[model samples]
Target: MAGKHLLVLIVCLILLNLSATFASKQNTTTLNEATACIDGASITLTFGFYINSCPEAEPIIFSWIEKAVSDDPRMAASLLRLHFHDCFVNASSFQLGCDASVLLDDTPNFVGEKTAAPNANSLRGFEVIDAIKADLEYVCPQTVSCADILAIAARDSVVLSGGPGWEVEMGRRDSLSASKTAANNNIPGPNSDVATLLSKFQNVGLSLQELVALSGAHTMGKARCSSFSARINSSSSIISNSPDVNLEYLQSLQQLCSQSDANTTLADLDHITPTTFDNQYYVNLVSGEGLLGSDQALLTGNEETRRIIECYAGDVEAFYEDFKMAMLKMGRLQQVNGGDGEVRRNCRAVNQLGS
Candidate 1:
């Protein structure tokens, strides 16, 4: 932890000269001054929702996350993606927004979100959430919801990865069901164009600027070879008509993916700082080194998205502020009002009746 703090200090110092403030609704440093948050179901979420029922909720979740990320730096990115996946997919009537449906395991009756195109073979770190949920159930059975665990874990993951911290509004309930179909159709894909990306964000109440800011999460993770294969594959037409990318950079990606095991090979999203949670993703995009077509689309997209991307690339502080705001807003997303939501004793399965 001390090492990460020192690293953050060095990064901030190096980039402070390039700082410029973007529009922000509240000061991250002053949590009390932050605006109130409510879920899509119209349930008011508050800080410290488990202060009395589960006083150790946050501490326990943080301890497990800190350990997991320490043991595997990639775990931080995985957990962060969990919250992101959990927060979206509301396009159809299923609307499993931020309800932890992504954590569900398939049963004999229904398929879960795990096998969705966006989630299967891509998502990880579920065991960590299971372990934390087991401990929370032992400490205060059914007091802390899996949805809340995901939100808090996402925040702590960013903090541990040397990014800004924000208060995660709590009191979210776990969804009783999961939707593989919705996940397939709703979650944004790496191949999506800028218009589809912005439309999806708006469908869920996020702004175009928030889409740019939230995409900054790409800084900490990696992408599969399939994710950007079209961007540089000489045989594919996405290359000739694609946005300008550095020649050497495109060649390197092509070489990496051309390997015999290309299907399973992974490429760092931010080649400069693969594991750090910083605005370097934007910086890389500015250089035309963004890993996904969806990412480079931001640069080639309309003026507003491009302007915000450049703002973040030049201003780390501004990026951090907007990211916190966006994450907070995303954490509050909920699709259902009341039916079939519960504080599950197990994250992967709903409680049996009369247990």
Candidate 2:
């Protein structure tokens, strides 16, 4: 018992030390002098080390962006996460599981005729960025782009969610076009079999193994019944009948998401690992209990993908390392940074400067 107690204490201390190290690494000293290269690239720059004369300006703005939706901490966190959630699997062309049509038609929609929205699998990061950008614009005018805000917000989100802190290279310019066609052609869908999914990831310069690991992000967020309805029911509208799906769970889900419109109850994929940012997502895959058909496909259908899943499921450290690399890769997708494009003052508004 004494030995066990000592072991637990040592592990806790190590974790605490790691946490402190992560915090120190993340809190960059505000820079006041000239442009310093942030991530080794000449274009990368930051303002962390310098003392702010208008210190209240940034804090008030940051705080406003964080709490513009409400005084709630969870809402603040959601603002930080909304950008990623919105763009993860863009379905602009298909509206697969999104309510984008509501915006297109006379019906009232949240973000206009935008191809993404209220999607179960949407990067929850979008909702937050909207609030943050609105607040920041009131303070700093045109100094910050939604893209830079997004990059910062995602890094902070990862740390707050208990993952390792990543170095954010800034100066990414905003995109003028939010192409529904680009999203449809690029974003991988829930029903995609492993090969199709791999091809999609490869298009973005990611490896097959990294593709399997990246799906672990689904472990944290909510999924609309529409997003997973095909897995649960025998409807040709969305998911096809696959041997890999769990029959019993599908029957239960049909009760919740039977509506043909695809808008209904949402399910949390990693119910056990809700906000912890851990490897239980991979572990769940091994149990033949992954929520989406696309999820289970990682462990089934393909031997190489399945083997990678097995490795990640068994080794937590390996999963963490792979996840970090995969995230870095995902963050790089379709970025219109620096010379690529101009920073949009408003994220929702396309770059009129380009036209």
Candidate 3:
């Protein structure tokens, strides 16, 4: 009788263990679903993915996507790829080593390609996503897609670099092709006047107002000495070239590039209020101190565009609302949805080699 009791007790213990394991698995599955849904929504809103349906899927997917980008440095690099393409579109000669055509003036290093330096303007924003990805990897291994990772990383990057914090809906599947050609064709240029900038954004369903607001992103980061050479060289009348930049703030930068040498560094067009996500970019336009050629063009170009720029510049809250809406629109561009692309195990590489 005692032997029979022992056998019954062993069976009961096994049953309890099985039940606990099943419960744990269910909890994990639920969490994954929620994370994915949010990530998908953020990407859809920001990049214009499968706009109609992905709203439900975003929250579920973000956990995995967020983890992949913030956990690994390599994953952050992969995410930075998208931003790199965006930045590349602003100029004709980003990677050409030395393209004199993009020179602002005769400045020595004030060349457009200066941002290409490994330490200068390269994907410094990826650090935020890298930290998140590391934590996610520890909790869930091999469960997230790198493409989603890229989307989230891009959103976080904007906020990290002293801009507005965007609502990043995740669960984006990885992209199979990283088209160098497509990237080159789509990006805008530093010399692009207001009209050109408007046409490009409108082609993708964005508006002129949005174009001006999104340009506010330029507020953060360093510009190569080359980017501002045009303003300085156009006339010695410019104060920056005459007195040398103030030492307390601008002194170190002047020393780094030299005063007499036209190789001077310019703040990101929106640097006056770089850390805050606000209407200062537009306000800068009103003040006649806008940075990039493309930026000033909004004010000086066509009448309709100038009116819109003025409106946004005058009203801070209006700019914030419009900027958010525009950001959501830009994030959804040309995304392939629903089984069109693989959920890449490694964002940098496609599917696992042997698998």
Candidate 4:
């Protein structure tokens, strides 16, 4: 009986060892899978991504952009807006990543974002991108990605237009697809109310403070009369009823945006410093001189947003600092890095072979 009990005990010990070994292997596999997923997602793109591969890429881009902006100061704002529009599309799960999808022309199977309602005839700066890309291709072949070019151009635009500059994280790759439906749905409209604008920004993980700071990009751009004529012409508009709007400003806008020429006439978004990038946009908002209804909505809608507008109006340095950080954060959204995407040969079209 004692011998039988010893045999049973040995058998139980063997089974226990087997179970332990199996659990150990299972835990290791789970850990490895988790680590790989984390590594894939956390692709930290640095500013020196092209230091070895294409040393002169940034300098070449800077030279062309500097010349372009020197000839046309408005090109800075256009370039900056191009970056914003390109990065703002729905990039999370849909792979509409910040891959210069907005620059793609419409193909039969895929409709590009360039002609979306908010972007049609409004978004400029494509020629500037083409010029820079052509120069880069000559110098570095396919070493640089259009996504990186757009990001760098945006940084250069702010510096040229007298705003603070930040180091743009590089190493992003271009997407193989473009989505007009995503662009039309994602890009905020000029007539969007404060709630809608907040929702759009929040959808992309941006905060209200960031939204207010980024909106200050309007300091250097011009809005067509069609963008805001309804505010002045429509009797029920908040601008018509609010005493905050300067009467003189209203009269000037009315004169500029007559019904017949609403589409052609353009007005400076920041009348105080029309051609410069500064905190004057926030100042304009404080005084009810904001160019678009969406611009004014910052002050009129939420207390926190209004407070931010007031703070930026009073503190230029704060605005610049916040704007720099906000832009960097926006540029980092859903970026394609590592071997996840490819560097396109043409910014306007996807790489045909393997992107």
Candidate 5:
């Protein structure tokens, strides 16, 4: 009983600190340096597999994450997104699971996913991963895989953002090639309807609940206006016809995006508690304030989605648990048919094209 009470006290203290740090913009120290993950017993290919081969691997990567996130709090979300974009790609020619193919650079012989419509100028944190891999190679050369680094970094990001964590499966290999074609087709756009979102998730072995839970990630980052301008623009059919938006909020969004660079303008996904990884995203959806049409679609998708949203909005712990589980499942995905797999000394290229 005392142990449980102690844990509760610790959590409360962490939340209090996070709120203070965020409430002050002058404090460039955005994301917290410490991790809040309370659990790590979920999945493991061989528990502590790196303990023997490269004891310094996880620590090295984690140290870099701490420094990077401390300097730029938004980095935590970018690392999490790096893993997400890495895992969702597919190729008609070859299989490319969570192999870190998304990190590859384009060559004369073939293309990569960076330039895909969903990814072009959208992804970040590549340099950070490069630094982590460089340090890993220095301590234990060629022992850690880029794919595994992404998974671990993602878990750490969530933990630092006041979310739950799970043991990431290690030993997953990296991809030898990336697929621009697959990335274009596989990743869903922000304007996707609930049906399209459901189809996309289902194609990757996820369900509707996972869909609702994973969308909760929106609780952190900001979405570019280009991604959802149609939903709030008066000239767009979605705004003119849809009944799922808050009029006052929509007006603010319109004014914000009215700039000539409106397409690149940014807006928070969750207006309430946008920095913390809480259940506020679900709460926003229930109130029709979800930034992206795809996100708001969950509320009106059907009874099941609506029920899941309401449940998460009412219970934060449940949202964390479900989000963690869904992320684990997403980390396991390899959408491409038969892509290459090997640990490259440099994450940007496969073994053959060593930098």
Candidate 6:
């Protein structure tokens, strides 16, 4: 009878332990599902997410960005593009939340997205992000997220570059991993045609109008000659013969993109106003002076895109309005927040146990 009682007691203890473990697993699963099931429109991001916890967060990030851009005006475009690339990769899949995955350094378990084909040698401004994160960490410790810093820096970049400014929704957290495959597959390349560009945008729930507005971002950046050399060299290129493209412009491009200089030379996307954030990108497209195949495709690809190009070309105010709205919408894609993610001590790697 004593032996039986002891056996019964052990059995009851084992069952209780099992029950607790199962409950813990179930809770973890539920939390993960909640984290993965983000709705861009209904996300919990706010205008002043760190107003109390880190009141000086935005000003710190903005000041850093302003000083960086003041030193190198092109840094404004680089930071803006960085934010877009980071968010676009996250928007590729629900599982890949908008965490600072793009900022991750390659680990044994995974390769970083920064070296992926679409991003390799193309994406810049990582150093600026690192610097901003370092400053925030010094002041706020782990209170601010790298993702939020990215969003804010992007906003400040545009403002300093003479573009419209919009309120950035914050409270994003960093992810544990980066996705090289997603970055390569989802990011539209310079050679992408209209259909490809449209599909890529639509995959992230962006509209055709939004696509046009976002492409306006190209107004301030420079493209490598490699991105457009084929257009100048290809037999099918209308650049050499098109009535819309100016002959002097084509000759100049040909000279700039000679075979020997393909990898080293760069061209402004908007030759007329390369440093400003305006509707001049659309104007360039309308005139067939677009620097990349992708840029020119906006005007020549579809009637709808062409109409948008025409509209933006004529009305800079309309482009600015739509660009701001599109940027806000894009920034919300697949965000990870709440208890599902963490604020990394460093932007380039996940926080270690002590560090």
Point to the candidate with the largest TM-score: 1
Give the per-residue lDDT digits (tens) of candidate 1, residues 10-80.
54443232222211223334433222221222335876578689877777787788889999998899999
The candidate 5 region of ten consecutive residues with least summed lDDT is 30-39
Worst 10 residues of 6 by lDDT: 31-40
lDDT of 2 by residue, 47-150 (tens): 33111322222233334343443343233335334444333433343322111111121112223323543332443345556666666667566556666565
Error of 1 at 296 (Å): 0.6
- Of 3 and 6, the candidate ranking higher by lDDT: 6
lDDT value, candidate 3, whole model: 0.46
As a whole number from 0 to 100, the lDDT of residue 129 in candidate 3 is 36
Residues 1-355, candidate 6: write the lDDT tens digits: 8974575455435334543653454356532232221122554577667869987677777778878999999999999888888888852333354577888888887887999888898888989988988888898999998888888888778878888666677888887778898888888999889999999988878877778889999999898888887677747556655655655676688887874667778888889988788889998888878888888888887899998788889988778767766777788787775665789998998887325
Each model's lDDT comes to 0.80, 0.53, 0.46, 0.78, 0.76, 0.78
Q: What pairs collide in candidate 1?
A: none
Q: What is the lDDT of residue 119 in candidate 2?
A: 33
> Which runs of model 1 end up more than 4 angstroms from their true locations?
1-43, 91-95, 236-238, 241-243, 335-339, 353-355
Q: How accurate locally is residue 151 in candidate 3, as Cα lDDT from 0 to 100? A: 50
Which residue runs of candidate 5 sit more than 4 Å off their true CA positions? Answer: 1-44, 92-94, 240-243, 335-340
User: Model 6 off-target regions past 4 Å?
Assistant: 1-40, 91-97, 240-244
How displaced is residue 247 in candidate 2, in Å?
Answer: 4.2
- Which pairs clash in model 5? 91-336, 94-337, 94-338, 94-339, 95-336, 95-337, 95-338, 95-339, 96-336, 97-334
Best by lDDT, which number?
A: 1
TM-score of 4: 0.85
Question: Candidate 6, residue 335: CA error in Å?
Answer: 1.2
